[model samples]
Target: MDLLRRRAEAVPRGVATAAPIFADRADNAELHDVEGRRFVDFAGGIAVLNVGHRHPRVIAAVADQMARFTHTAFQVVAYEPYVALAERLNGLAPFSGPAKTIFLTTGAEAVENAVKVARAATGRSAVIAFTGGFHGRTAMTSALTGKVYPYKAAFGPMPPEIYHVPFPAPALGVTVEDSLRALAFLFAADVPANRVAAIIIEPVQGEGGFHVAPFALLRELRALCDRHGILLIADEVQSGFARTGRMFGIEHSGVEPDLVTVAKSLAGGFPLSGLIGRAEIMDRVEPGGLGGTYGGSPIACAAALAVLDVIEEEGLIARADAIGERLSARIADYAASNAMAPIANLRGLGAMVGFDILDAAREAPDGLRARQVCARALNEGLILLNCGVQGETIRILVPLTASDAIIDEGLDMLAAALAE
Candidate 1:
């Protein structure tokens, strides 16, 4: 309590915190608070730990690299680990022909760089994003984001030439046709399709809500970009790294993008991100055009390598499927119950599940109810997160490494919160 009070005095309100408890230590799917309360972790550090907390492989890899050496600025004094990691991502990225990578330190940096790369390659200044899409917090990405309150409120004036179209969500009353038409309108009204550099989207939006974009929309957008020579940039920052039951979220669509911005769970908790794209497009920028000093920390590179090994060895991609099944089952049960009735929208891909909490008759969203459920879940020893433009959706991004027993226990706690 004293620490929280101290935090209130020390930290600004703009730096938000979801839970009141202060973390002391954490394991795979569990977190211990400063007061010795244990909470089942369903947040996964906001999708930054798909492999779980402190995996032995990730720990050992970071330790090994730290013992050897840390930062040498890859551009200044090149290192093999940096090159090795980029080579691995290059090979894994879903782009058709040859692909290349440039590392950054955060998802925002990666998003900004992806746009920069697209503009440089296409010689166009305009970019298109979607409603309810979340790219990053930087000035450029802020303009790309569709949400106004909270993230964008009081932060403008944002960078120019960024237009937003609707992201398809039938539950939200925005359909694929609506989004496509909006894109067409954007081209006609806002910017010429020929001058639009890129269209960035999340396969499953994270902060805006866990709304999955239909595969048909991806295919349509791909053909549209082909017609206009615009680049399609997938923002896989929160949905990447096997969180959506695939190596990359965009894989679910099977549509190749010109550029992809990735981060979040990339380095198991270490700060690392990348802008990966087609080789020719990526090479458009000359040497010294893109390089951040702390972009790809040697330690982070080592940890990322270990993360890949752990994902392959543990079969986390399949694990994500199993986890999603269990969570969906539990959510279905909760919705069917008389008390938790009319909870509209049970949707997501893989384990990235989220459902809206709606008022009686299921007509109006109930953000207050969502907040109550989260507070009760925290009190009952589970960490839950609420998202959506209206803050009425509860999204689960649990670690894929969590055991079935832990997942069930967390779900049970969540149900109890709903029951309360």
Candidate 2:
């Protein structure tokens, strides 16, 4: 209670936390508050802890790096860990041919740098994004994001030449054809195809509610970009690493993008983001054109290296698939039951799962009741989050490193919350 009061006074209201509990410690898929109460972490720190909280390997890597040196600033004094991580990411790039990578501190930085690189490569100023898609909270990303109310509200006048088309979410009554037609209309009426520099999309929409991009739409986008000379950028900020049963979500579509923005789970829990792109496009930016003071922090690089090792050694990609199957089966059972709230539309790729609370009529989204379920689940000692344009989604971002028992326990809490 005192901590809550202190938080209310010290923090700005704009930076909202999903739960009021203050973390004392966390391990794997569980967190303990200062009050010594435990909570099953279904949120995974908003998809940043795929390897789980404070994994021994990640901690050791950071500690080792610290013992060597904390920071000389990669830009000022180059570090081996940064270069090694970049090389590792480049080799793991989803696209064919030679690839390159540049590290940053946040998903937003990777996305913004992607746009800059795209513009430099294509010599065009306009960029395209999809409705209901979330890139980031930065001014440029906010303009790119499709949602209004919170992300873009009262923030304008936004930067110029950032346009959005409807994302094909059938549940939301926006079909793939509808999305394609809107893009056609956008080209004819709003911005010409030739003037567009890039079309950025999340292979699986994260903040827009775990909607997996239709492979058909991805193929069409690839063809359109090919014909128009526009770069296709896959923003894997929330869906990267092993969260989607693949190293990157775009891997599911089999439609290679020119550039990929990766973060969230990249460095386990460390603040490390990066852009992996084609060698030619990446080289478009001149020397010293791209970098940050703490862009590739040695500490974060060490952690990220350990994270990659963990993903491979732990077989997390396959584990993501197994976890997804388990989650989907359980959520489906809940949806079939009359005892639970009107929940439907359980969707996701791999372990990145989400379902929506609907009205009694089973039609429109029930944001209020969804909020209620999240609150109830929190009271039940499970941390959950809601997304989608209407805040009607219950997203499950459990760590891949989580044990089956932990996942089942979290799901059981979810069932109780739904019953309430």
Candidate 3:
């Protein structure tokens, strides 16, 4: 049977797969499908493989751990890799005060535990997120998430005490004042400020368009959380690790958050996520309250250690800034050269860059053109991903390991698609 036909028969329709081909192998920034076709991978498994697919060091680490023994269950028999990883992440946290780390299996799990920790520590139940922020697919996170339609639609009767206010996007006409006013209104009309336990936000709104929260606005939220005695949670699931220029996106704002949830690109392809926060706040959760059977698996921890090493040795943190500059410059030049193309509001933080697809008159976001551009790129051996609630944004999640040649090639393909 054809692969797409086979997938249709076996997999549920609710699960969305962007690329149609079945990958036979992937390395660095390219994926080879079952039909033996090569495609330059700009999506990076949606920002999961910053060190690129199957980096030699990461492969070696996983191999060595598997040979020793894969699972004794860290809960059943403690291991050193898990502890070592926690120490490394805790040390890497941007906060000055003492921090602690807890491992989980996915970004959603990290998010859930962050909220749980906030509620436990503060003895308050209400939580607030921003409009257009994408947290997770779980019930509470679904409630916390700002978008509806595909994520929250038909999954209703959501958990309560979760509210959303506007996030600043000056080009979109949503200003910092507009966001602050919405928050003030939320406090008055909906949940009271004192009742709120946490206010979670994405420094760079992922899956909701790469709208980097303004530095002043984040500082403002930090002060508000301080006044209300509420924990500030930064959902760095998509922008964490070295994907952005800094280790954490929130660091760009120079504001500290009480808790940060991380996952994608943490293990260089292994399933791992972490929730790091102030030690006092994290300690409030009772023993046995956070963590799962598969949480912090030794194999994943080993891979994570190797990932950190690769980031340092390859100087990927610095490379991310360079890549962001290159991508942004090339895309801007492409837009200038193609006057008829409808690209606008090009923005990003570090390597996490994207542009809005607008109508020919540049009056409105154009979801149809965005989708067509992405599909056209896929046919031309370049894999791209779209974002925003209206699907009117195309964001580059290219692997940091991609060479200058491959980056140019992929951008050329993107430019070709844009012209189409």
| Residue 64 error, candidate 1, Å | 0.3
**Model 1, 294-396: lDDT tens per residue?**
9998999999999999999999999998899999998998988887635779999899999999887778878888888899999999999999888889999
Q: In order, what lDDT does every prediction score?
A: 0.90, 0.95, 0.92
TM-score between candidate 1 and the true structure: 0.98
Q: TM-score for each prediction?
A: 0.98, 0.99, 0.98
Off by over 4 Å in 2: none
Q: Clashes in model 1: which pairs?
A: none
Identify the leading candidate in terms of lDDT. Answer: 2
lDDT tens readout by residue for model 3, 1-420: 399999999999999998888999999999999999999999999999899999999999999999998988777899999999999999999788999999999999999999999999999999999989998899988888899978887975889888899888966689999999999999999999999999999999989999999999999999999998999999999998887898899999899999999998999999999999999999999999988999998999999999999999999999999999999999888767655468888999889999989888878998888988999999989999999978899999999999999999999889888884
The digit string of per-residue lDDT tens for model 2 on 219-270 reads 9999999999999999999999999999999999899999999989989888
Backbone clash count for every predicted candidate, in the order shown: 0, 0, 0
Error of 3 at 212 (Å): 0.3
**Residue pairs of candidate 3 with colliding backbone atoms:** none
